[model samples]
Target: MGAGLPAPLGPGGEAVSTYLGMPNVRPQPAHAPAHPLRWGEPFPEAAHETLANGQMRRNLAHATRTIRDKRLRVTAELPDWEALRDAGAAIKHQVMSELPALLVELERNVTARGGHVHWARDAEEANRIVTDLVRAKGADEVVKVKSMATQEIGLNEHLEAEGITATETDLAELIVQLAGDMPSHVLVPAIHRNREEIREIFAGRMADAPAGLTGEPRELAMAARAHLRAKFLTAKVAISGANLAVAETGTVAVFESEGNGRMCLTLPETLVTVMGIEKLVPTFRDVEVFAQLLPRSSTGERMNPYTTLWTGVTPGDGPQEFHLVLLDNGRTKALADEVGRQALHCIRCSACMNVCPVYEHTGGHAYGSVYPGPIGAILTPQLLGTGTKGSLPHHDATASLPFASSLCGACYEACPVKIDIPTALVHLRGRMVEAEQRRPLPTGWATAMRSAAAVMTSGSRFAVAARAAGLGRVAARGERIGRLPGPLAGWTSVRDVPAPPRQSFRQWWSQHESEER
Candidate 1:
C-alpha cells in the first residue's frame, strides 16, 4: 500500500490499498454497499492524485476530443438526430413507468423460449446467481462480453474467491484485466493508458504476446486478439450485460465496435446475462430509436461493427442454455424521485463522459465507480443513496459527487436520452444539505454556504457584503486576484478569481436609472 494510504478490505476479505490494484475499487467502501460502484471515499482526494499525472491528462484530452469530434460529425449526418434523441428519452421514460409489467412480460416470453429469468434486488443476489449458474454448468472459468452489470455486482472478484476465472474479451477491458486494473471508461476501459503503456502491460502480462511488441495501435490490438481468442475457444460459459432488453420479444441487444461480444455469445455452450432492471424497452421498435442514438452518440458510428441480438436459446446455433438475471441494485429507489428519475433514462452511450471537462482532467477512477464520469456523479450516489429519512442510509463519500462537475451542461447536449445532468447535480446538492440538517451540526462547506445564504437573503445585507467585496482590490493584480487568504485560498490556488468590481451590479443599475430620472 502507498504510504499513509488506508487499506480497504477487498471482496475476498483481505486488506488492500485504498485504490486496490484496480483504480475504482476502494478497500471497504462503507458497510458493504451492494454495487461495485459505491465507494465511500470522497472523489476530490482521488482526483488530486490523478491530476498530478501529466500523462493521464494528455491521454484523456486526446481521447475525449477525438470521440467528441467524431460523434458530432456522424450525428450531423442525420437530420433526425434530435428527434431520435427525444424519442429515445421518451421510450426510456415509458419503460420506467411500466417497468414491472414490462419485466414480467419479458420474463414470461424469455422463459417460454427456453431461457431462465432470475430477479436480483441487489448486487449480492446477482453475484450469487451468476456464480451458482457457472457452478451448475461445471465451469471453473467464464469468458465475459464487457457487461456493466457484472462490474456493478463485483462479480469478477466474487468468482475469483470461488476459484473461477473470468476472462475479459474486449480489447480495452483486456488491457484493464491483464494490468489488474478497473475500467476507466464505459466504452474504452483503458482510455487512461496510451499505446506505450498498453505495450508495456501486454509485454509484461500476456505470455503469448509477440516477442518484440511495439507500441503501435494495430500491434497492440493483435496482441489482445491472440490472447482473447484462446479464452473464447475453450471457455464453457459466457457472461454479458445487455445494451437494451426488449420486453415485446424478450430479446437482448449487444452493440460493440469489435466482434468480441459475438465470439463470447456464440462460442460458449452456456450463456448468462446480468442486466439492470431499467435496461428494458417495451418493444423492438423502441430499440430502433436507441440503436440510432447510441451508436452515434457513443462511438461516432452510424452503425456499430456488431449489433447482436438473441432471444433465449436458439436450438442448434449459439448458446443452447441461456440465463437472464434482472438486477435492481437500487434503481427502484432512484425511480421514486420525480426530479431525479431522469437518470434511469441513460442508454450508456457514454456521450456524457466523452464531453465532461472534469472527467477529461481526472479520468474515471477518481469517481471510484464502475460507472464513472458525469453519470456516475449522479447515479452512484442514488444507487447507495443519501441518508434521507425514508431511503436506505449510507453516509459514504458518494455524497461529495454532486459537486464534481463545473455545472457545464455539455453532458446533456451530448446525451442521446437527454438526461438533465446539471439539474440532477443541483437536486442532489439540495438533498445533501437536507441530510446534513438531520445529522450533526454543519461544518466546512455546509457552514460556509449557510452563512452566505443568510447574508444574501436580504437586499440590504447583500448590498453591504457586495460593498465589502470591493475591498478585495487590495489583493488584486490587474483584473484578477491570483491568491486568497483563509479557506478561500483553495479556489485561487488552482485558478485565479476575478477581482470584485468597485460597485455591485444592482448599485450600478440603480445609479444609472436615477441619473436618467
Candidate 2:
C-alpha cells in the first residue's frame, strides 16, 4: 500500500521462497535442467544412460504394462469408444481452426466473469505474471496441483528465484519434488522410481516425512496427505494447469483422480491457472466427449475421481481472486504445419506413451523434455525450436526425439485423439533432414542414405552393389557377420547381421534362368 512498495498484481515481482526451510535465496531459473527430461543432450546419448539402468527399465516396464492393461479394459467397456475419440479430435480441430476468434472470446468472457486473463507469448512472461500475483497476495508460500503448463514454464523455480515457495500437492508430483528429480513419465511423474526408491526419497528428503516410513503405498499416501492437509488449510494461493478450457463458457475443467486438485481449487483465496492456449475446446459440450475419453485413456478409470470446473472468482464459495495466464510458447507456430498440427490435439491422456516400445524401454527421461514419450518427441522440438543444440535452456532436443521411436505405429493406434504420431514423427524427421542438408557436408547418416539411394535407383547399380556386399563374407563367421567395420559397427553391436550369401539370390536365379532361356 505504500508508495515504494510493489503494486497489487495489477500483474508481475521477484524473490525466492525457501524450500523445506533451506534459507530461501532469490529465485533462479530451474536448476540447469541437465536431466533426461531437460533436453540436455541428444536422446540417444541420454537413452544409452537410461537403458543401462536395468532397474529403471524394469520399473517402466511394470508400470506401463499395468497401466496399459487397465486402460484397455476400461476403454473396451465403451462400445462407442472410437466415436468418442473421433468427437474429441473433431472438437480439437475446430478449436485450432477458430483459435484466434475463440481466444479473443475467451478473454472477453473471462473478463466479463471477473477473472483477469493474461496473454503470454513465452515462458518468462508467464512466470513473471504468476510471481507478481504471488507477490500481490503478500504470500510467501503456495500449494499447487500438478500442472504441465506450469512445469513447462519452470514456475516453481521461477517463484523460488523471487523468494516464493510453491509446493506440489499431487502425490506422485510430491515424490518427484521431494526427491529433487525430473518427471520420468507424463501421468505418473515418478514411475521410474520403485516403491523402495520412493520410500528412500521420502525418508531422506521430505521434511515432514514420518519418522519411520515404510515402502508401502498406503503409508506414503498418508504421509503426503498429512503434509498437504496442513499446507492446504493455511495456503493463501494455489496454482494449477487446466485439462480443458471451455471457450464458450469461460470455464476451466480439470479431471483428476486425486482430490488434491480439488483442495487447491477451493481452499485458497487466490487461484492462478496457467494453461496452454491449445487446451481450449470450442464448447462445454465437447467436455462430454473428452470427459470420457481422457479418463479412460490417461488413468484407465471409468471416471476420474475428481472433476473440478471453475470460472472467474466467486464471492465466498471459492477463491475471491483468480488469474488465468494463457500461454502460447510456440503453439501457434506448430499449428502452421499441416501434418504436424495434429500434434496439438493431444489432451495429455498419455495413452500413446503407454504403448510405445521405445518409451517402454527408455522411459520418459530419454526424451529430455517436460513432456516425455511419443508426444514429447514431436512437441518438444517445435516448442523450443529445433535449433537449441548446446547447453542453453530450451536447447532444441528435436533432432534426437524423432529418432527415439521405432516408427511402429503403436503410438498412433494408442492415441485417444488420433494424433497420428508416426506421421508427425516422419514429418519432423524430414524437417531435420532438410535442415541438415543446408550444411556444407552431408552427415554420416545422410551420406549412407544417399549411397543406398544411388544404388537402388538403377537396376545395374543395384546388381553391382548386391555383388559388392559379398565383401562382408570376410567378416562372416558361421551363418552371420558378428562384427562390421566403420560406421556400420553400431548395427552389429547387439545383434548379428546375416552375411551376403555366397551367391546372390538374383545371381542364382539368373544363372538357371539364362540356361533355360
Candidate 3:
C-alpha cells in the first residue's frame, strides 16, 4: 500500500497492517471542532484578567525564575550543549521529513511485540478509543501519568462524563485536579498556585491528608504520596503520554521527576498511552540526544529522577495489556505549514515558558490552553487551523494567540530543539492579518493600519502627520502621555507612552543639511 493508505484492522479491531501513515498533506477542513486546545476568551482579554491577579504573578515569577536559573547552571556544565541542541533539531527535522515511513515502522514493530496500535485522526476519536479500552477492562477508575496529549484531548473530562474517573499521579497534576483548576504550565501544572494555597487545597480536598498539614514542601509531598498510593494499588488501568517513542525497537519513554510514573506504568494491569504522532524518534540511539537536552532544559537537573522506558508488554511482570493510541489531533494540519511545522519539534521541556516576558506577567492561564506560554502561542493556532480556510473565525480566541508575544526571541534561545518561535509568530501574524482583511466589514485594527499606510506612503502626508502627533504634548504630563482621549487610550492603559519628539527626524536632517551648506 502507498504511504497515504489507512491501516487495515484485524479481528480484535487493532490495526492489522503497518500502513497507518500520515503523508505530508493538509486535509481540507469542513469546520473547526471544539477541543480543549483553546477556551474562555481571546488572549488580550484573558491576559488582562490574569494580570490583575497579584498572587498569580508572584507565584509564576518565583517558580519560573527558580527553574530558569537552575537550567542555566546545569546546561552550562556541558561544553557540547549547543552541539547537542543542533543534533536534536536535526533529528526532529529528519523525523518530520520521513514521518510516514517512520510511523509505519513504529506500528509494525509495536504490533510485532504484542502491543496493539490504534490510530486517531483527531481528539474525539482518541478519547473514544481510550474510553472503550477502559470500559473493556471494566475499570471504573484509572491512575494516570502526566501526559500533555491526554490533557489536550480533555481525557479526564471525557472519562468523568462516561462515569469513569481518571486520577492524576503526578504531584503537580494531582493538585490542579483536586483544586479543580486548569493547568498553567507545561511541566508544572500548578505553577499558578503557591505553597499555602496547595496546603489549603490538600487539607480541604484530600480525604487522607494529615491534620494540620503545614505548607512545607515535604509535608505536602507526603500528603500527596499517601493519597496517590491507594489509587496506584487499586487501579487496574493506567493512561499516559509519551515523551519520545522509538520506531526501531517500538520502545516508549516517559521522563519525570517523581516515581509516580513508575508506579502508574507498572502497577496497572492494562496501560493505554495517547501519543502525538510527532513524538517519535527514528531509533533507540536517538533517544540519547533528547535525554541529555530535556532534563537540563526543563527541571534544570542533569538527569531526570525517573526515566522510564517500556517496550510493548512483558508477561509475568508489569502490565499484561498495552495499547498505544497514535493521535494526529491537528498535527498533520500543522505539518503542512512549512514554517509552522517546527512547532512539532517541541520536546515539552517548557524552556520557552520560563523565559517569555509576556508569559512571566500573565502566566499560562492567559493563553487558555493546556500547552501554554510561548510554545502554546504558536502551536495552538496551527493545531486549530487558525489561518486556514473554514477553520475558526479570525477574531476567535485562537486567532489572538499569535499577537500575545512581544516578538522577544528568548523562547527560541531557551528551546532545546531550537525551534525559531519568533519567525513562526510573525508568519502566523501575517496569516491572521490576511484572515482579518477577508472579513465582510473592516475591523478597527485594519482601519488604523490602512490609515497609517495612507499617510506613510507619501512624504508630505507623513510630514503633516508628524506635526499633528506633536500636538499630543498638550495632553502630556512631564514628557509622558498618561492617558489618551480616543482609540489610543488602550495603548496607554497598561503602559506609559513617551511624548512624541519636538522635531521629526526629517526636520532635523533638513536643518543639519542647511547648516552644512
Provide C-alpha RMSD values for all models, in order.
8.7, 8.7, 10.9
lDDT of each: 0.79, 0.78, 0.82
Largest lDDT belongs to which candidate? Answer: 3
Misplaced by over 4 Å in model 1 are: 1-40, 387-396, 453-486, 495-517
After the best TM-score superposition of candidate 1, give how far the Cα of residue 291 lies from its true spot, in angstroms. Answer: 2.1
TM-score: which is higher, 1 or 2?
Answer: 2
lDDT of 3 by residue, 360-419 (tens): 999888887888888998999988766323233334678878888898799999999999
The total of clashing pairs for model 1 equals 3
Per-candidate TM equals: 0.84, 0.89, 0.88
Q: Write candidate 1's Cα lDDT for 160-204 as tens digits.
A: 999999988766677678877777887777777666666677788
**2 or 3, which is superior by TM-score?**
2
lDDT tens per residue, model 2, 90-186: 8888988999999998888888888999999999999999999999999999999888889899999999999998999877788789877888777
- Candidate 2 displacement at residue 394 in angstroms: 17
Candidate 3 regions off by >4 Å?
1-38, 387-395, 477-480, 500-517
Best candidate according to TM-score: 2
